[model samples]
Target: MTPLYQVSDSPAVVSKKYFSRRELMPSQNSSVWQIQSGSVRTMTYLDDGTIVTLGIWGAGDIVGSALSTIEPHIIECLSAVEAVALPLDRQNKMVEALAAHVEQAEELMVIRSYRTVDSMLLKLLGWLAKRFGRTVDNGQLIDLRLTNQDVAEILCSTRVTVSRVLTQFEDQGIIQRLPLHRIVLCNQETLRRAG
Candidate 1:
């Protein structure tokens, strides 16, 4: 689908536009980067050796929203994903606009509270269900194509641990692995309980 910003620009505006129409322009200086599903991008490191997995942005989500203030970039995509690179000035403005929403501010607190790997995984699964789930004959099917290694990066855990947890869930009949890199939630209640 064409972005709203693209349709809003006039032909004259498009010709002299600082940002490309193909990119989702969050601000004037926005740039676009595209990636297929299942790729990795390196990230910046902290002095304390803490690695932050910003967010696994899917088809419609925006990236670099949180780190646009202090630094140019705080997180990098660990998988093949698209990122629209907004200039620092534009990013600052966007953050200010976002700050006005009380619900947006509260989301940061909720995200911060999931300090443990397991908690993060559970929370992420729940989020994916909400964002990209499709109702089928049996249950909700997660549309995001993710692997255990991808889960490890997002959850800040080893792949082994992620695999074990997934196996446990499968054994409990909470979810089932489908062909072509998909996962189906057999029972939402059971999955929530496991989480």
Candidate 2:
């Protein structure tokens, strides 16, 4: 594993690396990048070239190709990101990260299993809201800057379908779309009723 940082004769200092949105993060053999801010999605391609999103990670989450056994693993920034490389030597930390990955995978699997795309997308929005949203005056606000294409990639659906559903959601007063791809879920009660 190549070291990401340079060693000097002075005190040790870990530097933060910045990544622009849609940029691919470097893979290391013996280390992982811990996100200091923003979010990223780890993914891989199938035999037929279908893209499979492994997981979405945010602040304080660790990501690296070394942690995955899948071939052609990649981590792509979902927003402007700041991260630091950390040696992958801590067993407990790795365990937690792996567990989170598995749990989220299962959650997404269930979300995609819904009979209708509308149901699936609604569930996905609720999950994203719970995971990455912040409290606003009206409800939870999801400001991940994810485009319809990005949501389609995560849901394993088509971008047109996702866009239509989002428009429908807005019309039904289930959510409010803001600039920069932000979404504000009306309320937990509305979500439960929609489901």
TM-score against native, each model? 0.42, 0.52
Clash count, candidate 1? 1
Q: What tens-digit string does per-residue lDDT give for candidate 2 at 48-124?
A: 46677878999988788766655677899999999987665534665557646765775676567666788878888
Q: Which stretches of candidate 2 lie over 4 Å from their true place?
A: 1-91, 193-195
Give model 2 RMSD, 1 decimal. 13.6
User: Each candidate's lDDT (Cα)?
Assistant: 0.50, 0.80
Distance from true location, Cα of 41 in model 1, Å: 30
Q: At residue 63, what lDDT does model 1 achieve?
A: 40
